[model samples]
Target: MDKLMPQIESHIDFFLREKLPKSMPMVAMLIGDKTIGQIKEVFVSEISVLFPQLIGQYADGLLEDDRLYPMLTEKLQSAAVYSYISGTQSKLKGLFSKVKWGALVFGLIYGLLIGLIAA
Candidate 1:
């Protein structure tokens, strides 16, 4: 073998330089115009622009679907809600206590007037 490696390398180079083009003509559309780096940049920019809106919508959907009803129910069932109602009731009771005698007299007069009117 008289320097077989160099001969093989020369033939391979010749094939790549000449025959490859004939066998496969370069198609610009098939090998897209944009580079991998350019594509990655566009993808990153688009995601950055849309990510917040997407996350907001997703969070809203989760709140509507999974949290609203339970949250309302929890509030309705909470001791704080009952305490608030009881606080109002206790205030009314305190007011009524201060005016029980007057209120009773007023009620009796109001009832007698209504009964007289009816009769």
Candidate 2:
């Protein structure tokens, strides 16, 4: 685990710096201060859950090579990206819905005002 710390930290840094922004711009914007905190939380949570089992498997020679490390990183990245993208999509949908309602309300008010003036 100690041996893996540096690499894991680097991966986390890379994901936060490069991947998260490109993948989920809305979430990043919505939670500007909390973005890094949320990402680090996810990273720690995932690593804590998986690292022990992974290390055990490596020690038992169950894993063929160090391929699992990269695989694990990819899995973590994918999970984060998926989570953020879903959240962003939901936010966007809600925003669009609100805009639609606002337009409808504005249109109705404008039509009523015109009708009153024309009368």
Candidate 3:
């Protein structure tokens, strides 16, 4: 267990630094796609009542996808998202360090208690 700490920290650091940044674009795209879909669904019914069926579908495709997808993707990939992720990663690192120390202390105390009980 003592020898495992460095390995665990290294892997977690790698993931937070490397994999997360690389995956952000895809995550943004997915979020944009989902948001646009939901928005289109919400408005499409009202639009259909106001227009022909074909026109309504065309409006749905054009209005939401063309505008909202890029907007959402941009928003998701903006500085705020990255900053939030950075903040969370730092917090997680701090929490992990605390947990590591806590576990060590708990293990020592547990062992000492067991030894004293046996004696």
lDDT over C-alpha atoms for residue 63 of model 3:
82
lDDT of each: 0.68, 0.83, 0.69
Enumerate residue pairs that collide in model 3. Answer: none
lDDT (Cα, tens digit) per residue for candidate 1, span 1-119: 23444564455545554565567667322433254335445645565567678989998897779668888788887868788998999999989887997889999999999999999
Q: Write the per-residue lDDT of candidate 3 for residues 35-118, one digit (tens) a residue.
A: 645644555444445546667789788787767888877888886878899899999999999999999999999999999999
Q: Across residues 25-60, which tens digit of lDDT does each residue of candidate 2 receive?
A: 875576554667677778877897799998888777
| Candidate number that wins on lDDT, 1 or 3 | 3
Displacement of the residue 13 alpha carbon in candidate 2, Å: 2.2
List runs of model 3 lying over 4 Å from the truth: 1-64, 79-82
RMSD in Å for all candidates:
23.9, 22.3, 25.6
Q: Rank the candidate models, highest lDDT first.
A: 2, 3, 1
Candidate achieving higher lDDT, 2 or 3:
2
**Top-down TM-score ranking:** 2, 3, 1
TM-score of each: 0.30, 0.40, 0.39
- The alpha-carbon lDDT assigned to residue 28 of candidate 2 equals 56
